[model samples]
Target chain A: MSTGDFIFTGLGHAYLKDNWIFRNYRGEAVRGQVLALLGPNGSGKTTLLKILLGALTPSEGSVNIQGQVAFVPQLFQVAFDYTALDMVLMGRAKKVGLFSQPTPADEEAAINALERMGIGHMAYRPFHEMSGGQRQLVIFARALVAEADILILDEPTSALDLKNQNGILEWIDRLARRENLTVIFSTHHPHHAYAVADQALLMLGENDFESGPVGDVLTEKNLLQLYGLPLKRLTFDYEDLNVETLVPVFRNCKRRKAN
Target chain B: MTEKTVKQEKFSACSSGRFRRWLPKTPLARPWILGLILLIAIIGSLFMGAYPIPWHRILEILLNSVWPFSGSESAYLDLREITVVTLIRPPRILVAVLAGIALGMSGTALQGMMRNPLVGPDLVGVTSGAAFGAVLAMWLGFLYTPVILVLSTIGGIAAMLGTMALARVVGGRNDSLPLILAGFFIGAFFLAGVGLLIYLENPFYPKGQRTGNIIYWLLGTFRGAGPVKAWTIAVPTIVGGTVLMGLRWRLNLLSLGDLDASSLGINLNRLRWILITVVSLMVAGQVAVSGVVGWVGLIIPHAARMLVGPDHRRLIPASAMLGGLFVLGLDNFTRTVIWSEVPVGVLSAIFGTPLICFLFWKTKTKGWNE
Candidate 1:
């Protein structure tokens, strides 16, 4: 197998002396591949994402990526009420000269990106006013305008509703497949990862990680170990298509059949 | 590589994109229209003040000065009228306009860099530091215009460095709270330093004719406006403001906060410091020329933002023009309409405080977002 455009070997980080958040993390994501990061709260998932985006340096190890990188943070409110077009146009930040503004062609590219995302109608609408799912799409359009071959997202669907979550998930798959983009994302929902990810990195604890193909890494055992809750990886038929998903055993629910 | 990619991505009828004009929707919001208004105001302001020079005569004086042929035919014009029109009023007017532009542009840049509308040169400790430098220059008996200007710029940069250091110590870029506190701390410290210098100077030079200069610099006014003073402020504002305008578009990206902007391939520290240095130069020059003119720097940008919205490409030029106009108008009001020789600084604070209060009250209606 060929080594991918993105590779991080023996990655580690610590905010304080002798207090590593995580260490000895090694991973690589190739073209058109989707990698999902699964970890409990404070398991250095966001920190790892930052390291890949080059926003922060790991305490020990280095990351090397061959192509452009675009980071889609959580659906956030900007300080100013910039239009969706304005937000997307800023993706040309690299092409824009130090002493020059974005030209008309650059603006056209931004508009085309919005249209490609199927949100061309609301290009002039304020970004802060957009729905959560739409905002994620807008950011995806931004990554496209940036010509990013690597997309790093942190909890892209966290603040979104269930329908919006599906919308985001579909786009994530479509962008990876159609554009041949390397996509790395973190999520609380393992089913979302199981449905989409080719490779899974289960960050169970500091220096303790299980990573490989989804078939190997995303097991009921890893799910239980990762969340400290009884989880079932169930397979069933739904509307003539075979389906596989993870469901956790609840604390109060009487339905213990999955467990 | 970029050129290759550009051609490969086939364009699909994106003819309706809003790049026709970058100005705000309203006619009054246009920077050029406001610039024209400022020109008319500048010409109109020449007719104001204690020595009333008529419009036609002032026009003749101005035209003759520039177009030598007009003055020869217009020898009927009084020499005193020519002097007042061409010499005295123009210098003061230029000084006021330049200072205003400096304040406005500086405020807008500061706000954009900090990603908070509340930030200005004064709030960031630049104005006070520059003021202290100018006062110190006077205390040391160095009245050289360039020396005062240079020292003031150095002082402003020093103060900005202090503010940044303090901000980092407390909290980093994601929060604007620490920046505000640091600015306030450094500004107050510099103001005290200026006060001590003045107190120390008076004992040695009791009959030194320095009190008037002290009051002028501290309170801010056109009392000392002259050709030299105008140049002291003009050079920096024109040069620095141009650089600021040229780089204004980057502010939109920078406003996305530290982590986000950095991820976008911006060298956050380098870009931020460059912008900060330019802002310090302009603000310091204003203080060197006209003293620490208070509320114009702190508040005029808000009025500009109201007219132009938050896009820095439009906002920077709009603020600069709007600032110059505001300063010229304020100076005219105090110089002609008001009975007292009220310092423009005092008047600006008087006018500016209410506007800030109004802005504060407006936040409730606008909903907290920043």
Candidate 2:
């Protein structure tokens, strides 16, 4: 299928009867293009993604995603003690018959994904023992192993370090370019959108939002409005540094006032 | 790499490979292994009891009992030995095995559904609910075992629904701790109801009434268990277990959290209802037959996970087999090793605690949830 074949639209979603989580949200998410959704936390970024993923039903609008979509959840809740390979095999759940055990091919596919992510050595590691960032990578690999035409990631690099974050972004960028996989990701970071997104979706509020090419939606005015801050997107000498290096600078927002 | 990272990598390498390699290859293998051991243990179970039957004779009697048409023209193959093997031993062993399998898979399913290792009938109100129902039926002079079974099953399912509904009220993902809390409170509510019923029954009891017997059975037992009860419990547990195995993918998806499951083409609401109903049915049937055997459901899953990886395809069947073996083994111990017939429930508590503690200790090095 072509990249622009499917369009995702959300009519609305309300958390309570009155309080709208998202409303009248209409957007076209194309295949083969990386779409980055940017908004403040709890501002319906994840909710919009969930709607697109068909996880949540929009109260007022409709959502349509074409073809099979693989999702990398923001936080994975694992109760059972599964292995890294076991977790990766879960990505193939849609393909494998319900009663069918993981075939050798499935295992090989999982192994390959882990290896490509530089986590081949930890393929047999207990999932619970891995670091948060490492677990996130495994979850990403899980999404990738599905070989779904559309990959939806929710803050995939939120927990990663500098190197891993860059590695993941590069991997995602390459996947979108080469494999022609449509990618939809949600993040709070403006730079991340600038770096990886072909199209940026700015959820303005419960009632307002905009979607366009990355530069247009990630402009200073839109980001400032979205964050509700007097924000400036300044170029720094540490541009070479990945997003993780900027985490301390970004996370210490209250410290700026103290200074 | 940092020293910590290197250590972690080294630790992970050996640990993951060794554990994965150690896991049982086929789901069938665990049961085969456990079944073989349990067969031997059943022979041991038969050897026990007041009669000091020889192993060879026990085997002969067992074979004759099962294969009555086999042309064994031995005078010693009489009704008493047949009664020992067929009437007494088989029914009792069957009950124990069924109870174990039921509790084991129930725990496995509940743990998977709730995503909590600590949750089971005891913590989740199913046991107490069924106990109250069974006790109420008995105290009300319902002499029929089938009636007690029906009442207890309904009671257990009702309690599970109430607990789940309470979780729904809390308004978050249906998680382990919240469901546990819901079960705890609901269980306590049912306990109070049982207590009130007992208080009411006290006025009608004649001298030497043994009111405590009802309470003791609720603690759990395998006494006076017959084949009828075995079939009643076994059918539902086996059927429910089959369905659970069928929905392994959905269960695994749910393990990723509700939203993740929905996105992956699982109809979350439909599945949630189906799984809860099926699980409740199995648990109710089990509670009806065996009062409320504890730990098997909670501990068996962990044990099964250790043997087979947490892939439900393997974990579910393995849990069922190992559970059956564990319970039968414990019941055999309760029957033969002691002067008094100790119930399997009490023994499981006595035994399962130490094993669980050791499990926790063993997995402390590697993350348990992993």
Pick the TM-score winner: 1
lDDT of each: 0.85, 0.74
**Which parts of model 2 have CA positions greater than 4 angstroms off?**
A1-10, A97-100, A112-121, A131-133, A228-259, B1-31, B66-73, B76-79, B139-142, B171-175, B202-213
lDDT digits (tens) for residues B1-370 of candidate 1: 5532442352222233555433345676778888898899888888888777777887888888888786665868989998888789888999999898999998988888888777789888999998888888888877877789988999999999999889989998557799999999999999999988876775667674796678666898887588898888889999999999888999999888877787777778888889878998998888888887887876877787778767888889989899999999889999899887788888888888998888778665764363
lDDT of 2 at B265: 56
TM-score of each: 0.94, 0.85
lDDT of 1 by residue, A56-84 (tens): 87899978887889999974768776778
Model 1, residue B235: what's the lDDT? 95
Worst 10 residues of 2 chain A by lDDT: A242-251
Q: How many collisions per candidate?
A: 0, 8
Note the DockQ of each predicted structure: 0.43, 0.42
True contacts kept of each: 0.60, 0.53
Tens-place lDDT digits, model 2, residues B203-280: 556733636767667667888778777787777887887888787656666676776665565566776676777777
